[model samples]
Each structure stands twice: as C-alpha cells, then as structure tokens.
Target: MPTLTIRNLDDRLKQRLRLRAAQHGWSMEQEARVILAQVLETPAQNDGAAWLQRVRQRFQGVAGDDWQPSDRREGTERELPHFDP
Candidate 1:
C-alpha cells in the first residue's frame, strides 16, 4: 500500500474537510482519498458528439444573420439585365 502526505494545509480548509467528512459519515482521510480518486478518474465522453451537434445546430441558426454575402458575382460586379420594349 502506498501512503501520501499533504503538508501546509490551512486551518480553515482542514475544518471544512472535517465537517464534510462528518456529514458524509467518513473519516477525513477517507473523504480525501475518495475525492482524489474521483478527481483523477477520466470523465465519460458518451454524450460528447450529441453535445457538439447541439452546439453546431445553435450556431448554424445564428451564423446567417452574423455574416453578409459578397457583392461581386462571376468575377465582376453584378448588374441587372436591361429590358427592351
């Protein structure tokens, strides 16, 4: 088994940790261990694509209004055709 030591902890932080451990029915050491384990674990990416898709959909709706199309057409300025009667 490996042991870790944390030094220079502030009194207020220690008190808060003790209170939180008591509230959760765990010792301070155990609480810290569990928290550290959770912090080090990789978060699941199951919903990443869905979240990206939703963000893209939202931006797509707003993108049209945020940019204007260029005025030039076919390598020249656009001109209306004249009609003869």
Candidate 2:
C-alpha cells in the first residue's frame, strides 16, 4: 500500500470532509477513502440490458444454448435456513 499526500488542501473542502465523516461516523481518513473509492469506481453498466448484450457479444457463437439457466435472473430471493440454538 502506498501513502497519498494531499498537499495544500483547501480549508473549506477539508471542513466539508470533516462534517461528512462525522455524519457517517467515520474517521477523516476513512471518509476520504470511501469518497475516493466511490468517485473512482467504474460501474460495470448502468443499464443491465446493455451489460447482458455486451456479455453476449463477447461470447458470441461460442456454443451451447443451455449455458444460461432460464431460472437465473437478478433479485430472485431464496429462503435462508433456520438454525436451531
């Protein structure tokens, strides 16, 4: 892991970060990290349909129609097993 030194950071921006960190109950450093990760994070695709299309294009004519299960779709819930204590 490398250390990042933000030199000559603006007072207002730093104060805002402090407030945000307090709101989220995080340290300033943790808040900065979360902000950085969120800003730099690249979403696979905003539109799920577009993402599926891209996957299909990448695997175009590869083989086997049964590779994708018809039962599989996003947000399908399964019941969790109850544990006896």
Q: Among these predicted structures, which one has the highest lDDT?
A: 2
* Clash count (model 2, backbone only): 0
In candidate 2, list every pair of residues with a backbone clash.
Answer: none
Q: Which stretches of candidate 2 lie over 4 Å from their true place?
A: 43-85
Tens-digit lDDT track of model 1 for 33-67? 98888877845545798778878978775756658
TM-score for all models, in order of appearance: 0.54, 0.49
RMSD of each: 11.9, 16.1
Model 1 clashing residue pairs (backbone): none
- TM-score for candidate 1, please give it: 0.54
Task: Tell me the lDDT of model 2 at 27.
Answer: 99
In order, the Cα lDDT scores of the candidates are: 0.85, 0.89
Off by over 4 Å in 1: 44-85
Q: Candidate 1 — what's its lDDT? A: 0.85
